[model samples]
Target: MNWQELGKQVADYAPLLGGVLGGPSGAAFGTILASKFGTKETPNDIAAAIQADPNAALKLKEVESNNETKLQELYLKDKQNARLSHKDSRMPAALSIALTLFVVLVVYLLFFAPVPDASKDVLFMLLGVVVKEWSNAMQYWYGTTRSSSDKTKLIAARN
Candidate 1:
């Protein structure tokens, strides 16, 4: 729905829903019954009288249905937003992880594998990339795995 229409709907329905959720109590019901009955009556007395009145029950049912519809609409909007965000981010995230792993492998071959000083600049650059990625990945998953739960207990005991 467009923003303007959605805003209008919220403006119109919020008060009605608030009244229904609050039930036919307090000032609203007092005003309604006082005007109709032309006497002072407590909210509970008004409610008991309304229970015997078929017309009031029908009006209440209509309000309850409209409130349920509005709640369903809001829930579907949230679900759609979550789906769109996850779909947009998945591919780029996988590509970043793959690139980091490739750089790490290349660095290992150049620095630790049987290779000479002629490629030292390339080796250092690759090594730097590997170390950066390793540190970042470690930080990202820190305390995220099953083993970390045990580590946490140990640290807690020490403290």
Candidate 2:
């Protein structure tokens, strides 16, 4: 019934909950909230851990409901905050010009990279592929760390 045990329980059920929610967000939020605010034990486990008082049960239910509401609110707030803070092209015209120039430069490089060779195009394409793969790997790493850290913090909070 301690936070550590409760956290393990949450982690155990997270995959199932993630499937139900169709995303990792739901499972991560549920696990964190349950561990942070809800009783140390799951709803079913609560009754036996503490005295089965009607008032306590009612309070527990209230807390669970509020936790869910708060979780949704937090999620929405975070989304809104991210949307608001996300890059709003300060100079769209300039950005477009820069992008066009970059594309032209790439084309120029592919056609003529100091050395007249078909391998230039192949090397450019390989470089682009490598950059794309690296970007994807970084994004995946960030998302995973964020979710894992969130769960870790909630678990640590219990101790």
Candidate 3:
């Protein structure tokens, strides 16, 4: 079965694992699922197990909850790696700045400019995408509350 199909099925039970299954690291996450579920390391096997067992969803949730700490560590590590990799590169910051400027321009145009009826729909769609991406860019640059909390926990533990 395709990753998307498996992800959809698993998402109903384990949202986090489902997301991982649907992402770029689906195969790796599938291996984890397989080990936990005692299935073959394949989406098809995992999907079948989830479908066959009535308690599979509960089990999946339990598994995710139990491994939440490890998952958070992995997530934080990935973000740290990304930040380190981009430390010397200006592209990420430049992109964020550009996106900020574009969002401002789009909002200004929408509020003040006389947009043509035919182009308004396209512009609105573009605006939606740009705004969403701008939020993501800001989050990447500033870090999210979850990340901040994790940092606090780390510091507390270190002390």
Query: TM-score, each model?
Result: 0.27, 0.30, 0.51
Candidates arranged by lDDT, highest first: 3, 1, 2
Q: Give one digit per residue, the lDDT tens place, for model 2 in 1-159.
A: 443343343333342322223322444444444454445434335424334443544444454455666545555665656544633545544544555555566667666667457677676786586556555544534667446756766998999
- The residue-by-residue lDDT of candidate 1 on 1-159, one tens digit each, is 222332233234344433332332224334444345344455454445444565654544454464466544544655555544655455545655776777767867875798777877877787787677665655544536425645766998999
Instruction: Show where candidate 1 strays beyond 4 Å.
Output: 1-88, 91-96, 111-113, 143-159
Candidate 3: tens digits of C-alpha lDDT, residues 1-159? 877678778788777766556755568777778887889988899888878888898888887787777655554665666666665687878999999999999999999999989989999999999999998878866778448756866998999
Pull out the clashing pairs in model 1.
none
* CA error at residue 82 for candidate 1, angstroms: 13
**Number of the candidate with higher lDDT, 1 or 2:** 1
CA lDDT, candidate 3, residue 60:
85
Distance from true location, Cα of 38 in model 2, Å: 9.5
Report how far off residue 131 is in candidate 2 (Å).
12
Model 2 segments more than 4 A misplaced: 1-77, 87-96, 112-159
